[model samples]
Target: ILDYFELTKVDKEGKMLNIYLQEKNIAPDGHQHQDLESKGFFPEVEIQDFPIRGQKVALCIKRRRWTIKKTGEIISRDWGLIRKGARMTTEFGLFLKGIFG
Candidate 1:
């Protein structure tokens, strides 16, 4: 799932490290087709990640959208990288659980 994101930029603001990523061109239906056209990007979502050098790290991910030329259906890949009901990566959530639970 992490491989879906391509590292684009990185920023450091005080005690926070922000990592910007762009989602790779992945077929929503799990099969590549010629009818898919680049539509745009979804709203940026921030998900907390493991701290680095005592600085809070967050991943700003931008998921891509596509439009099917034949049907004009908007499609986007639903990558379940974040934990349920939490603005954090699944791996980070599991790490916290291991420490606190």
Candidate 2:
């Protein structure tokens, strides 16, 4: 799933719920992204009840962004799809790949 695409793992800075990449590098993550993506979701799942505590996708920028860490290929641009419930590392890394690639 997510691992199949190769995503970076990143964390949000400070107490805020926003996350971003440092130097636009591919974000990193520890989950079996491959397993999740294999569920056939990838960047196409309806997210509600975000899995993270006190974290929510409230901004447009927080909704779209994801890529393949290996090739730096963009998978989606929906922030709501990238934040919280899903791993931010792969999303951020792919975003970095988008601009840098």
Could you say which candidate leads in TM-score?
1
Over 4 Å off in model 1, which ranges? Answer: none
Per-residue lDDT tens digits for candidate 2, residues 5-97, read: 333333454544433221122233543262222112233332232235766532112223445556555553223344544545456646656
Each candidate structure's TM-score, on Cα atoms with residue i matched to residue i, is 0.91, 0.21
Q: Mind giving the per-residue lDDT tens digits that candidate 1 earns over 1-101?
A: 55677999999999999999998887776648547988889999999999999999999999999988988888898777999999999999999999999
Q: What is the C-alpha lDDT of each candidate?
A: 0.89, 0.37
lDDT of residue 82 for candidate 1: 94
Worst 10 residues of 1 by lDDT: 26-35
Show pairs that collide, candidate 1. none
Candidate whose lDDT is highest: 1
Candidate 1 achieves a global lDDT of 0.89
